[model samples]
Target: MTDIEARFWSKVDKSGDCWLWTAATTYGYGRFAITKRQMIGAHRFAWETVNGPVPDGMVIDHLCRIRLCVNPAHMEVVTNGENVLRGEGLSALNARKTHCKNGHEFTPENTIVTKNPSGNGRACRECRRAAWTARATCPECGGSFSARNLARHRTNQHGGSHV
Candidate 1:
């Protein structure tokens, strides 16, 4: 084996089906140094060593879900979105929901596509409308007003002490 190959393999524990890297890790992924100052994911290194460079716009997904696994066979190349949707993260969990938390179906008409900090997301229109309507009522004076007029309503009707 070449020097880098030998160094890479030396840190792997091959006892299990998944070849676990037993060295330094970052965010659960094994870290390997290819050069004195450059470091890369050990799983990516293993996949590249076996199957060549990963294609642009594609990321390595651990099919085994073991971040420490460096076995190329346990990995797959997929888009970042695809990778996230395939896993059990919050985005994936939300994507799998056919209905909202309040039992409203996420139909084309009922679903509102929104931009969140993470990315695009779907919200139930009924729930959103209900929430907005709930906010439109003044709790102190029991008066109904538009959402834009909430502060004005409170200031004029309740002297701003109701907030």
Candidate 2:
């Protein structure tokens, strides 16, 4: 094993949770219970111990499914996307809820998609619902508009102002 890996493994206890050294920083700035900094350090140590420096764009995945585990045997190199999926951190798994705060259910019929500069998809169903509600209430003039003509109603009947 590389010297760094040997040093880390020698200090790990049986449970593989605690580290020999307290990590200076944790994942997501302490969002996760496991210290990711220590995990990275341990991974670096392991990689150097057995295979020399890790190549660029290589991410270490935990085969043990334990974020804090530093066992060299349990670490494997994988793409960042694969690592995120393996860790269950994909956006699809944590997308916004189907219903808004007002209990309005969002479906394709009621949803609007906005394009991000990076060409990513961002849905504004909640915003669309809020706009519809606002058009109904006419927050400024307190008048309702027909659902189909809310946009024109807001700009014309509501003093030519966009909501």
> Which candidate number maximizes lDDT?
1
Local distance difference test, each candidate: 0.92, 0.57
Give the lowest summed-lDDT range of ten residues in model 2.
Answer: 27-36
Runs of candidate 2 with Cα error greater than 4 angstroms are: 1-6, 15-25, 28-40, 90-114, 117-119, 122-148, 158-163
Residue 110, candidate 1: how far off, in angstroms?
1.0
Per-residue lDDT tens digits for candidate 1, residues 102-147, read 9999999999999988789989999888867765777777877877
Task: Please give the RMSD to the true structure for each candidate, in Å.
Answer: 2.9, 7.4
Model 2 per-residue lDDT tens digits across residues 1-163: 5554455565555563433233333552111122335345554564456666777898777776655555567778888867765665445443445764566666787556566775444455776655666535566677777565666777787576575
